[model samples]
Target: MSTVLQLVKRFREVLLDGVWIANTNFKDQLKDVTWKQAVIKAGSLNTIALLTFHIDYYIAGLIRVFEGGDLEIRDRYSFDLPPVESQEQWESLVNKLMSDAERFAVLLEQMPDTKMNEPFVAEKYGTYLRNIDGMIEHWYYHLGQITLIKKLLSSDLI
Candidate 1:
C-alpha cells in the first residue's frame, strides 16, 4: 500500500475504528461514556471530556492546515474544554472528535507520498509524517489515560 494510505489507516486505527493496537479506539471507548462519567475527575488526571476535546483540538487544527489554512492551535489552549454538563454536550464533543478524525484521515489519504517528507506548516514543526506519527502517539497516550481513568471511575475505590 502507499505510504499516505498506510498513514490514513493508522490514523483511523487510533481515533475511529481499528482496534489492533490498543484493542480499543476512541469511538469504542467513548461510546458508552455518559456526561457525568466523562466529567468525573480521577485525582488530578484530566477528565475524559477534556481529553476528547484536547485530541480533537489538534486534529481539527491540523485539518485546517491540510486544507491550506494556518496552524493556529497552541498547546496552552488544547485542554480548554467548555463545560460538559449534559449527555447532549458530551456527545457533541465526541461527535466532533469522530468527525474531525475522519476528515483528518481523508485529507491525509489525498496527500501525495512525497508530501509526507515536506515540512508541516513550518520547519520547526517537522515533516508531515512526523506530525501525523506524533498525533497517533499522542492519542494512544491519552487513550491509555482515559482507559485507566474509566477503570478508576468504575471501581468503588475512586
Candidate 2:
C-alpha cells in the first residue's frame, strides 16, 4: 500500500481500537455505579458521560470535514453535553458514536491516496492535511481524558 493509504489504515485502526477499548472499559466501570455517580463532578467541567460524547462529537465532525463535507462543529460551545441519567441513554449515544465512526472509517478507506495530501480550504483551518493532523491529535487527546475519567469513575466502583 502507498504511504497515504497505509496512514489511512493506521488512522482507522487507531480510531476503532481506541473506541472499542475505551467504551468497553467505561461501560464496565459504569455498570457498578448509578448515573449520578457516573456524572459526579470530578472537576469544574466535563463529567465522564460528557467526555464520552465529546469524544464522538469531535471525531465524527473531523471525519466529516475531511470527507469534503460542510463543517459540523461550527460553534464549539453551541452544543449541550449528554446527560448521564441512565445507562440506556449512554449506551444509545455510544452506539451512535460507533456507527458514526464506522461510517467515517469506510469513507476514509474509500478515498484515493492522492486525496489525502490534497489541499482543501476551511474557514478555520487553512489546509486539509493540517486539519487531519489536528484531528488525529485531538482524538487521541480525548482518548486519554476518557481513560482518566474512566479510572476516576472506576474508583467508586472498586
Candidate 3:
C-alpha cells in the first residue's frame, strides 16, 4: 500500500470505521448519543458535542487547505461550538463531522507519496505527514475522553 493510502486508512479508522486503536470510532461512539447526553456536563471535561465540533473544526480547516485554500484555523476557536440543543442540531454536527472526515481522507488519498514530506501550509506547521499524524493522535486523545465521559454520564456517580 502507498504511504498516502495508509494515512487515509488511519484517518478513517479514527473518525469513521476501523477500530484497531480505540476499539471505537467517532461514528460508532456518537451514533446513539442524544443531544442531551452529548451536552451533559461530566465535571470540567468538555462535552462530547464540543469535542466532536472541535475535531471537525480542524478537519474542515484542513480540507480548505487541501483544496488550495489558506489554513485559517486557530486553536482558540476550535472549541467554539455554537450549541447542540436539539436532535436535529446534534445530528447535523455529527453528519458534518462524518462528511468532513471522509472528504479529508479522499483529499489525502489523492496526494502523492512525495507530498507527505512537503510542508503542510507553512514550514512552521511541519510536513503533511506530521499534521495528519497529529490529527489522528488528537482524535484518539479526545476519543478516550469521550469514552470516559460517556461512561461517567451513564454511571449514577455522575
Residues 1-158, candidate 2: write the lDDT tens digits.
86455555555544655354334333334345455655677766467567667767766776777677776575474246745677677667667666776776677677676766666554456555566666666666665665676677668743
Provide the overall lDDT of each model, using Cα atoms, as 2-decimal numbers. Answer: 0.92, 0.61, 0.93
Report lDDT (Cα) of residue 54, candidate 1: 95
Write candidate 1's Cα lDDT for 1-158 as tens digits: 98888889988998888889999999999999999999999889999999999999999999999999999999999999988889999999999999999898889989999999999989999999999988899899999999999999999978
Pairs with steric clashes in candidate 3 = none
- Screening candidate 2 with a backbone cut-off below 3 angstroms (N, C-alpha, C), the clashing residue pairs are none
Model 3 lDDT, full chain set: 0.93
Please report, as a residue range, the 10-residue window in candidate 2 with the lowest summed lDDT: 21-30
TM-score of each: 0.98, 0.72, 0.98
Q: In model 3, which regions exceed 4 Å deviation?
A: none
Q: What's the distance in Å from true for residue 107, model 1?
A: 0.7
Q: How far off is residue 119 in model 2, in Å?
A: 2.8
Angstrom error of the Cα, residue 16, model 1: value is 0.9
What local lDDT does model 3 show for residue 12? 93
RMSD of each: 0.7, 4.2, 0.7
